[model samples]
Target: MNKLSLFYLLVMVALIQISVPAITVYQNEMVLYKGSEFLFKTIPLDPSDPFRGKYVTLRFEEEEFETLDTSLWQRNESVYILIDKGVDGFARVKRLSRKPMSGNSNYFKGRIKSFYLADGKAIISLDFPFKRYYMKESKAPRAEAAFERALRDSGQQTFAVTHIKNGKSVLVDVKIGEISLKDVVSESKND
Candidate 1:
């Protein structure tokens, strides 16, 4: 192939590699937004990345599987987890199954972390798909600081707004005390 042709091919390949995941994420998010929305309580931490800008590290509240049967469980095993709103109005894991079930409940695909025990409970650690919510560089710091202050206040709660569809999940927003991070930053600007 000609040098110019080869160069163009390389560039196209690189672009595809970079853009495919981003495009997939956007598409998945759109699906989630159009589907069922769920809430999961979270503890947020902020950190900056040179390439991806700043994002909040999300640790979900429902990481422990209270009634999981470990007999058939294996390290790094893939599982389909059912999601339903709890009495507190937060989305929580209803069950883990080897295959996705059809019903009104939402589901997400996750992997089981290696065998472990905690507090006399047979814990099944889950690795959720969406862990970080990327934010604009300028706004991330403000959001982080606000979240930290809210965390210190006993009245505030931090939670992630997640949406699920067809066993796919997306993190739509991170909220502090019922206000979204973006809105909180904008509200601060008016004060």
Candidate 2:
């Protein structure tokens, strides 16, 4: 740790801090299980992506919609959103889905969703913008577990979740739940 080396290390740390993503994650970032909320970590896992469609994007993280802005909402084309627990324990978030779900709990179901971090606040973007991320700092045990799952679950690294706005990732939210890729796709179909 010579003076120059120490300065380089300090600069690297600063860059890392600046480059980290901004997101509100659940406990352990392992909200993959339906009841995972029963146990959680304030921190979440890193954000990732394989690719996205032209009109939509997909997300897989330790935490789902965590924090959100309820002002921007619609009921037609899917929009991304984060659910902030209202006083009633019923989740409330920005209406990301283009159209509201008719008798469905998941409006943006099947479609890709994103949680954006802006102005120290969070916003979500639904749909696809291609492979992009902000890689938030999630150090929870669940985050690690989710990461391991991402790697070994698919026998490959399945990245976390992140949202991009104007070509720049604004926020990233880790996903959690016991729903498997098949289950997530089928869960909405059952509805």
Candidate 3:
């Protein structure tokens, strides 16, 4: 190829690389059990950014993981979450633990907190990195509908938030509280 063409190609490739979101592996490679459930005790947080829109941020309290064999598991690796909760209470998630509960003195009780699956990452939903996920008004119709359906079926507000198994994210479901999300858009309209 000509030098000018080669330079242009290189620039295009560089820009593409820079623009893509970098995949961050979980500090502890763990996979959540597919049929398990969760109930996180939400620790209230302050408003983040306008771009994020609105959502009731959370810190998970109960993370019920699928019982898996020690051999199939990996330490600190991320696994896909499945099955959201219903109004009755409880959300099911994939069993993804940092390390096996084997030989540990502490019991992996239902009180297990600080873990969630969103945006293709296994998040602990802590102070430092896990951030509120919000979506544009135009996108919420489908996203909210699916979320609502899952919530209805489970009879709980707790989410069975799952990651894309194929690793190709056509639509990343940004969780926004129904009330909070409505308020943000409605207030703007009234104004």
Give per-model CA RMSD.
3.5, 15.5, 12.0
Per-residue lDDT of candidate 2, residues 34-142 (tens digit): 2212111222233444453111123333234434444443323444332333463333443444444443332223233445566655554444322232332222323
- Candidate that scores best on TM-score: 1
Model 3 off-target regions past 4 Å? 1-6, 18-43, 47-57, 63-90, 94-131, 134-178, 182-191
lDDT of 3: 0.37
Question: Tens digit of lDDT per residue, candidate 1, span 29-102?
Answer: 67676768888888767887889888878888787677635455788999888988999899888788888788
Please provide, for model 3 over 61-142, each residue's C-alpha lDDT reduced to its tens digit, 9 standing for 90 to 100: 4333423233243334443333345464543343434433443221221222344555554544222122244545453443
Q: Look at candidate 2 and tell me the lDDT of residue 36.
A: 13
Residue-level lDDT for 33 in candidate 1: 64
Worst 10 residues of 2 by lDDT: 33-42
Candidate 1 weakest lDDT stretch, 10 residues: 63-72
Give the residue spans of candidate 2 off by over 4 A: 1-58, 61-82, 85-94, 97-131, 134-146, 149-169, 172-191
In terms of lDDT, model 2 sits at 0.37
Candidate numbers, best TM-score first, in rank order: 1, 3, 2
Measured against the true structure, the TM-scores of the candidates, in listed sequence, are 0.78, 0.20, 0.33
Q: Distance (Å) between predicted and true CA of 9, model 3?
A: 3.2
lDDT per prediction? 0.81, 0.37, 0.37
Relative to the true structure, candidate 1 reaches a TM of 0.78
